[model samples]
Target: MHDAPGLVAILAYDGLCTFEFGIAIEIFALPRPEFDFAWYRHSIVAVDRGPLRATGGFMVSADAGYEALTEARTIVIPGWRSRDELPPHALLDALRQAHERGARLLSICSGVFVLAAAGLLDGKRATTHWRYCDELARRFPAILVDPAVLYVDSGQVITSAGSAAGIDACLHLVERDFGAHVSNTVARRLVMAPLRAGGQAQFIAAPVAQVPRHDLAAVLEWARERLGETLTVPQMAAKALMSERTFLRRFKDATGMTPKAWLQHERMARARSLLETSALDTEQVAQRCGFASAESFRVAFRKAVGLAPSFYRERFGARQR
Candidate 1:
């Protein structure tokens, strides 16, 4: 947690979005003593070691410039002024050095441009705001830009979609580093959901189906209620009263994932909830989630979430009072 020699450095550039910059500061820089653990040691580092003006007529001074990148364990690049402009050579070098030294790098919204310019995202699967996805992909053909996701965590480098998705990315970082409980605590303080289902497309507008299709919704609800049961696509399709092909098509159209993928995600989510909120062991949790065995649950959970179930619960679960 906070006891670790971890410094969270935010890259502050001239003409940066004050709101996006503020999101990083609010999440990482704020002091919280109730948790009885030290949170991140935070600092604002300018791209150039000088006073910088934010987008909305406010100026902020920083402690250090690119030099601060070397000392940081986690580097956060919020939003840049423009995507067309490249980051300065000095800043790019510093970012490269930090990454080479094993610092976790993050870019929120348009900040992906900085990482892209630095070549950190050259061959990586990354994302930015949905609006800039086309531009980002077009500019850097080497990078795999997935616009449908809210955020993509490719180990040391993480990039989030626009605006509030940055909050999700930051909380995800906290969850990854300190565990789920700490993340949930911080998320509660911020008055936002600890987790969001599906992808960025869920937030976008699309043509609604002309037919009223309550069947898909009903089947999903049924599956959720019967998570402990041996649920399969055939069972789900049967409940929806459609052929498997038709059901799968409509399911993907509505939710952007197949029924199997959605079920697995739901199962993992339920496993996390039970892990955090109850005293259930991994075995019970696995059974509840229809994973058949604790070993299976562990493998699936780690594959989906990048952490083991026990570790996730330890970090996120509330202590028994």
Candidate 2:
């Protein structure tokens, strides 16, 4: 018999950050009938004894207590009640034990403080809401706090910035576990983009003016449909019927990334899909994804995916028994 995916324990405490907690539940607890494989098993763990009162004047009843964390393979800490207040000693002990046993820990927003208080974030790079980055670095001198990024994935421990960024981190974990296809499926259900690179800026400064590009939609679709070709910024600009200079400016304004970066993202996404679903060999896959050659594909794929192409296929590709 095949083994089930790991259990996810989402913590619930008094004064819970409702939106952050909801994001965890929505991503990990929802039934995913689309996939044939076993979905995650989840339990709501109570950090505070008795009934927990969440923000927005609602109560939360947990499925289990701190002891339940021992059985979980992944623990999700939503935003803590207060960043200044350290978590309970019992709770901190449980987290330390879980980490020692090789369980993964994830934190959203101020929840990073909980992990920090447990001493789990020492010597690792982490991120939190941009507003708290200074304090996190101040309180935990051992941690390297990056204020700009959406999230930081340090193997066993992952941390994300404020509210909505939690969704990006959760989706990233899903992708890490089940591959790009599964992650994209979850994102589709959530009505969000399949993947946003972790290095993406958490906050974008206001633009001088919003560019109107109702026509750029067609150009983007065109680019996707022709990823196999040697497409250039000039070509894309021509397709959008704008000068290259104007296209570059408007494109960055419309999407968070530059035109070249967006194209690379699209190409990598297509490569992942082909790797999982197609029978193409590495060279063919590279050609289809518009890579210059197999060696270039290998380097880029490894850099982007943290795995060699062959290894990724071996791990996630469709198998024939």
Candidate 3:
């Protein structure tokens, strides 16, 4: 067998996330004899000694300690047990040293807490599971928190949203290192989409958890009805009888997104449904979604949906009407 280029060390701790841990192992550790290219070698190292409890009701013991992290080219931190509990000093130091020596750090879901504790995410754009996005932002004010994306790759440090997004991040790393074809092969073996066509926003039912106050809810309802028309911040404010400044502030509070971002989100939702249900072509879909131009619609749709309109329609359309 051809030797792989680098070793991937996964940091396993007590109360580990079985799903995220499994994703990391499946992507990097699984044997792929079908491909001639050497894959990453895998090592599961304990952040501390003894047995680690996985979230999926199992116990696992690691053969190595945190020191293994120092020698790894890539280190994976699966979901952390709690954001409240600080990572061990040795673990944090090893992460810092590894990062300084040019090792790539990846965190799945709440495992970002460890990176945050190590100061690796300071001033870097990061993402975590949507459930913890607010808390991550609140705790680490310096880190730019983007809760909407499936993952954020800030060069050396990469983070993924909850659960399956970890697979996306791992596959992304594979694509970045070995190229698209290799990643796609691995994805096929795993029976997953070669490239998922969406972000965390599609999965989030309530983008904003807090119940909007009466006025804000009314404003949201009004905007919801007008997604096919050009919506301005001032117009949303006027509907709620508020000034522009207040509207912007309250919009963020009510939706966990700025008015512009929320409007794009809403429009995409409408466009996505139309693409799924209507026989209208791309240009018609864009027009009905209130996009200024088909080009702009394509850009926004690709960004929000993680795939082109044609692809989404092909994948999701229900005998287009």
Highest TM-score, which number? Answer: 2
Runs in model 3 deviating more than 4 A are 1-3, 207-321
Writing each residue's lDDT as its tens digit, candidate 3 over 70-145 gives: 6789999988888899999988888999999999999999999999999999999999999999999999999999
TM-score of 3: 0.65
* TM-scores for all predictions: 0.85, 0.89, 0.65
Which lDDT tens digits does candidate 1 get at residues 230-321? 88888888899988888888887778787788889889878877888899999999999998888989999999887798887766676621
Q: Cα lDDT for residue 109, model 1? A: 94
* Model 1, position 287: C-alpha lDDT score: 94
Error (Å) of candidate 1 at residue 55 is 2.7
- Candidate 2 per-residue lDDT, tens place, 58-151, comes to 9999989988899999999999989889789999999999999999999999999999999999999999998899999999999999887888
RMSD of each: 3.3, 2.6, 9.4
- As for candidate 3, its clashing pairs are none
Candidate models: Cα lDDT each? 0.85, 0.89, 0.82
Candidate 1 vs candidate 2, lDDT winner: 2
Better of 1 and 3 by TM-score: 1
Compare the candidates by lDDT and give the number of the best one.
Answer: 2
At residue 55, give the lDDT of candidate 2.
96
